[model samples]
Target: GHEHSLTGHKQRGTVLLRKMEISVAEADKRTGKNTVNMQETYTVYLIETRPAESVPEGGTPAAPDTLWRRYSEFELLRTYLLVTYPYIIIPPLPEKRAEFVWHKLSADNLDPDFVERRRVGLENFLLRVASHPVLSNDKIVFLFLTEVMNNLEYFIFFPETQIIALKIQTRFISAVFSRRFMGLKHYSDELNTIILQLLRVRARVADRVYGVYKVHGNYGRVFSEWSAIEKEMGDGLQSAGHHMDTYAAAIDDILEEEEHYADQLKEYLFYTDSVRSVCRKHELIQYELEMAAQDLTYKKQQKEELATGAVRIFSLKGMTSKLFGQESQEQREGRIAALEQSIQEGEEAIKEKDAECQEFVQKAWTDIERFKEQKDKDLREALISYAIMQISMCKKGIQVWSNAKECFNKM
Candidate 1:
């Protein structure tokens, strides 16, 4: 049990050193290099401030008869230093009461370098506060003074100062104010102020330490709340980074799809242009076919008119020959021979025109039929190509949609 108690005390001492606002070298110097073994001999130098009030058997508060007196400034300062100073320092000064007066003097407009001077002066002061043997030990007053000093420490950079002011404020508030909701009739406003001020000081101190270390390249510990805040900011940034990545991918996909669509559109335009050119040529062919048909009909009409004129001339020739009355056999034979030759030549002329007209009609119809067949074939091919293009476009659209859905799910 003694060994365990010694181990616990060593652990506490180590922890206290670790918590100080000092360098490792400074902590080592303050605590010394002595090994904290269970069997080690150590001397305790504490000066008891006061005796604790005796409580009843049931742990009840003492009656009004057990009166407790208040403390004087010198005695209070001495007691307060022993208690509150440890909260700030590592392996705190054994007798720090004399240092409190120096801190108070420094706060009252002493030289800026007084803090260094006080550090030196304290070496002698601790011995005096410790060796003094006439001081009363009032534990209650000391405990109250410790709390008062801690509260005052927010506004005053000192080991201990006018801590009684804070206690007076607390007493004043408690005496006049009562909170029914909290069931707190004696709660101190001065204590609340200390808590609020401490929180504010913690934040300010953290910022100062961080700023100084960053600028001068020095040392300090991180505030407890800083890690939590930094973690939250990191999470937010990671989330934003993911969103940006998804957006970039979507943009890339859209650009690729647009390029593909542009390619398909270019192909479709080429095919449409080709079909339009073919259709233009087919239209020209149809026009030529109509003109050929008109030319053939005109030629047929001219042939009919020529055949009618030949028949009229033949009739006139026969009438004239009859009216003239040929008496000699030689003259009549020559006239008959000439008339037969003219009639043969007229029939040959008619046959030749009819053949030529038939040829024109056949050629015109053949050309028109060939043009119509070629045009129909071209139109069928164009329709088939257009249908195929539409099917391909639909399939591409479906593929793009599926790809987009997949990308979205991955996101």
Candidate 2:
């Protein structure tokens, strides 16, 4: 069913990343079907949106709008988008509960570091959606970015008419240009396995790396104490200790930066599910078409048997007919008429399902191609960045030790 658009405008806009402010508020929780419990201490993000810099000629640029959105709301928006556009690879949201967190760090959702990471992730999600060629034009996305709402429940409940029209147009285009395309089921399954394994191994490696850097802190402490008792080597030992301390302290910042790359990998990991969903939807349509064709074939066989007055096979209907006496001529004619009507309906259903399947496959394959290009570009950049960061960290470690060595040589 078509629904009224909240805002009539469908113009694409830009989402700006503004600083997130933590607000403590009482949230009403539904403990049961009719129960309302007050939950305290929830985090909300301050999102800002503005008209794109390249506004059309003679068009007035709208002032930036700021709205306080909760993390759960972001989850809601993502869920809505996934259901609405199953073919498109929707941007993944950050992990709501911090996983594989350092032992020293607070694992709580409201932890400052965790919240900050989530804020960055949420910002990226918005930017990705805004930049999507098709998603950017969606009214729901536009409303999510620009509209101020006291209650978010009302926001997604209404389906926009523009979206219905878009779907209709998409179906028509798909039907005209439809062709057989390879399914992503096998590809997505393999990719998911590889990504999960990588994430697991990377997590273990990161944990060990964290411990190794932190162990340097002990070396720094030991050197400082040794310097206090030394005569000729005191200054040199102290300088070396300082470098050790600096290297140890740098781990926190370095690891935090590395988390960003992990997030990028996680995005594609989540994307595998979306790709599989398209394949599953297509399978369902294919199944329906098969069922319809099978039903039609049975009806045709029944019509042939009635017309030929064929001897009864060992069947429940045939046995009943024998016991009650053969069906009258009018009864037989009526049965044939019913079967003929059913056959016609079944044929029509088969055609409709086949067309629907073709259209879906075409549309889904088109988006998959687009997503593949994007995935290649994004993963390439992410891997390059990760390599560079590792190189830079190693260089810094070398520089620290080299400086420590020079200090000892001067002594």
Candidate 3:
């Protein structure tokens, strides 16, 4: 019944932020002594979760469950997801601190604009996790959305046995998909590099655009001042100044919207790391498999030496035997028996590892395909939305200046 309920919720659950509040709290500076040496201001977002099933017609709607979560709590949740699902590209949290910031923009994390953007980013991260077929059904994730826990400490406290089991499972899976995994790694790395370059160029362009918009504000002030000195043309000059001011004010909203698009790009940039993580896991598995195979071969060689009574050239075991005098027939037979047992066990281990590797490759590749499809769809929509926004911004600029031209004609 619990599994059925969880499945139903996973199929239709929705997560959203209703609002955020900023508050100051005393924090220990960790300077050896236990004392609150700093007052830190942080945001607390109000998360709201609606029922999975729709309300019946003419029936009272179910009240959504609500809880407050700090940004640090979000970080904790994301970290757990990253650890638990190394193969899935866990959605990235918003930047904890702004980077590549424009000189004109405030870099303070507490700044209202920055906090608001983070709020949106946090909501998007939760929605992404909630919508994932596999991630959505996670017990911890479900609890996170619906439970009113004060802290997420329990979520991170997995049993040692479970962790070991997970590590072993991942290790086995990674061993068989070397070539394809390497290809995925290379592609992700290249894409990450290109996105970083694009973001850098965008920041520089935004700085210039900011300056250009401020120049229009200056032009507006000049026109308004000139209007004060004019006779018949004064009203027209004042009207033009108002149009210029409106155009100048539009840039802030435009740039803020552009930053949203930039965040979308950064999501993929972070995704590359997750992709490389899978590649690294695969390499580790392959390395483990190779070592096991090599050990088995060495064991077989030992068995051969014991059976044939011949020592391979420059062998340390052979040299030790020669220095200490050869074993008696009984001792020799015991050594051969031990070697034979070890070789048998080694063969069985190799077979098990091979089977595990094959299973892992199949599961991993299937997940990778699903991830690729989601990535393509998301990227296509983001790019198209960005293009449309740019076109709309240009149209607005044209309309503003044209209105100013009409004001001049009226004069």
Candidate 4:
């Protein structure tokens, strides 16, 4: 489909963020199909915008882009962005709207008002994603905003390619034959190298996650030991006829710092596990790639052998078999198309994995910054305050002892 405009403006500069609406009611067969399939209806988000930077003065204002995305799709897009841009904090999705009484799994989720609530949530979600420093520049946000088409049909048929293809493969075929036609080994090698690097980084990321958890654990121990010491000091100060609680106020700051650290540690741990899952997913994809390359190579070799007349022929029956056994152009194209689709899918999968990695690493970096801020700076200041309090308390104790000694001498 061509993006033809009546006003003849094909490409606009930057589409400014203006308004977004969630379209609950629409008269389209696709939306109808969606409603029927899910037994519940979903809404579309209409992103209205005027290209401020791109449009010329007095030029015709183009129509707003119509975008329809399901809640799951919105979730997927958010996850994709999170994976792609690690540092940016993705905006949260709208709460699941219920049309009726609150329940875990209610059909009310599909109600018009409920859907509207969700639409607003999703709109907010997109705006946040677009306004962010790093995420705004990403093409994915643009694609999500501009593309209205649903790929439900594509996903349904895509997995079947593997099943249809597995029948074409029986056992391990020689890389030699396939290499003569299409370069499977090269692609495989390149992928292997890239995946290996990713795997190594993944392992390091896992280690970092574990390391942060250990730091949090060690801090817990520090708090325990500090509490015990504080209690002992409290008893001593009380016995010395001083108010220990006044000096103990400094411990509250320390306690708050520990809480902050604990929260940060939990966030890091979650991302760590998330990145590990992504790595496992990619590892599985790598195996699939190897097997897929084998399948593509098989089709390629048969096509090449038939074209060159390299397939052996001993008798008239054998000749007939050889001629008939030659792969047809259509089948060749299908295999080639399959390989391309597989590659495209792999690339998309990688984009997700890369984003997860960014999320993992960015959290770690941000944690480091927080550590410096909270533990290094704030904690140090708190400790100094505590020390000053201890010094002042000791001075008070010294004065009391001196006065008591003076009284005893007078007695």
Candidate 5:
């Protein structure tokens, strides 16, 4: 899951440290024995170890559980002996571990040189086992060894290999749910386990093979073959995983868009409802104001009619008597003045109300347009961003898939 660039450094470091420790032990042992020279051997071992430390740690960290202290020259010696040990003397019984090793060695389908070496190792190992008194009659050991060798041969001969076989296993899971291969319709737990095991082995071997190829700088037939296998499995695994990731991302984007749109729609609905409510209230207010204006007009008309009637009565009175006519004239003038002032005030009040209504109508139109424009801009930007993101994602996927395909072809 994490980056692994520094892994090479760590492995080389551990190996060198082991070599140093072995040298120290050997030097100490020789010192105690008096016949051995530590000076020449120690310097040679140190020289052999110099370049190992030069390999800097790359990007990855060493495993936490790994015990570097446990690695020693003795361990390396032991491994070398184990590798070559079968040829020297086979155990009383066919060693299960040795069989596993031979299986891996044979699985390479490597050159004749390697094949010949492995054949010699196995034959000698078998001979050693047959020479053992306790293992001479053990048919089970022979059968197991034969099966191991056969599988190794099969693996080597196979044209393609899956690396994620270890992950395809089915266990004691509920029958309601199951995982199956792309073409397979039925479930077989045993087959799944085997698949997963093979994948693990494939991954391990591929890493080692790649390392060797890189170090040797030979990119010919063998490198190409191994690379092809790496590509095949890597693509298969990545494809299976990538599809889900892409789909999930797309779904998330859609949901986010939906939520944003829903929020805007909600706001739009709110404003629309407000506008409708205001319009209804405005209509009601307009109707009431109109009724009030009509009432005021009627009142003014009634007042004017009374004033005219009074003036006519005063004129008739003045015709009958001069003193009474003078007093009635003054009264009529005052009444006319009061009625004009009242009418003027009423007209001014009506004008103010009309101006307020007009302002409100203008504001409502402007606000609606502003909100619509803002929403349009936001939607446009969102769509553009989404389109760009989709394009980028597609490009990335294509590149990854192509790289995987190329790897497989080379392998």
Candidate 6:
């Protein structure tokens, strides 16, 4: 998640943010301050934090912070962020992994090195979210950075039902959804590219298969005609050099040709069916891609008509300012933060969709390659059988002609 969003930033030299250090330690077992009683000692990571904005006294906000959080706390924070920002593509957390080792009971999952690695990963995850223009202003994220997360509760709590109505405004939702919808359309183009490629490959393979089928059909026709001739001449030769042995030998040659023609027909039919089956499977994927594209386009167009800005009365200092409804600096920053979040979320979503489309196409191509290999083997086997039968039939024809000549000499 972080990779897609930042890879471009790194390349463009747009990634310049202050770094935060993270360190982990065994939780103090002696501190009898467990709100939720635990059976065993756990670990926690200490995060470096800074104030959200300037202070009135021009001092750093809450220096020497108490921003220590455990793994479960991190999980809780992630869950809250997902619920709160359904429109944003939040960065992923490190997996809780259990690794095994032979002969020795592996405790690597709880090992210091392992915990340190996880801490670093978690810290980076937060940093990525913080660097995002919109996610940086998220209240949950602020708590993750500023306070010791002791209270296991909701990230954004509403005082009442009325507050809930005010917390997520209609305009805010419209802005987020609009950006997300546009992001989907932006990435759907890549899926379209993949579908086109698959079609081209299918077409090319069909052309070659059809060409082979035509040749094999003609060969089969020749064999059928020879078979008919042999059947008609079964027990007699109508010509002056007529002989019953010559008719029997012709039947043997026709039998050999039957094997050759059967093998050809088998290959032809197999390839034709294979082409249809492969195309049919991929066509379903194509349909899904097209539908996803259509859905994104429709959603984007619907929301694009809505206003993309947040508006609220922002006066907080003076009575006169409040009466005039003058915009406060904090309010302006909040609006800017909202806009920035939408833009960043949209970009992250686009990146995610692009990656998914690429992966899907890559898997399809891999499957196609495997299918081609299998079909190639089948084709090779068919050709080899035909070749072997043809050679045997040729030898039989030579021997039969020799006997026929002897018979003619005797006559």
Poorest 10 consecutive residues of model 5 by lDDT?
41-50
lDDT of 5 by residue, 190-303 (tens): 333543454345345434533542432332333434434674565544443344344334433333232232222222323332333333334533544575688679658756
lDDT of 4 at 266: 25
By lDDT rank, best first, the candidates go: 3, 2, 6, 4, 5, 1
Global lDDT of each model?
0.33, 0.70, 0.72, 0.44, 0.36, 0.46
lDDT of prediction 1: 0.33
Q: Top model by lDDT, which number?
A: 3
lDDT of 6 by residue, 1-411 (tens): 111123322232212223332223223222334557755556666666543332447655455344567777777776566444433444556546522111122346666544644555565566556555456666566666666545757555534643343333322332212232344334434434543454345335434533443454444354445445665542222221233234333543343333233322332333333333223333333444555555555444333422332223332434555578766667756655665566556556556665655554465345445434543554465546556755764575566456546643543
TM-scores, each model vs. reference: 0.21, 0.81, 0.83, 0.31, 0.29, 0.32
lDDT of 6: 0.46
Q: How well is each residue in 1-411 modelled by candidate 4, as lDDT tens digits?
A: 011011111121123242332122331213455444665344555555434454458986565446555667776776565444333334456555432221222346555534544554455456545544455666666666666556533322324544443333333443223221133234334434553454345335434533543453454454445445564443333333222222233333333232222222222223333333323333333445465556556555554554555654355744765678756777657756775676566566656655654454455345334322322342244335545644664575466556434533443
lDDT of 1 at 12: 28
Q: Can you write out model 1's per-residue Cα lDDT over 202-282, one digit (the tens) per residue?
A: 335434533432432211112222323565454433333343334334432332222222222222222232232222222
Poorly placed runs, candidate 4 (over 4 Å): 1-31, 34-40, 53-62, 86-88, 97-107, 152-411
Please give the clash total of every predicted structure, in order: 5, 0, 0, 3, 4, 1
| lDDT accuracy of residue 190 in candidate 4 | 49
Cα-based lDDT at residue 247, candidate 4: 28
> Where does model 3 exceed 4 Å of error?
1-39, 58-60, 158-177, 313-316
Worst lDDT window (10 residues) for model 3?
21-30
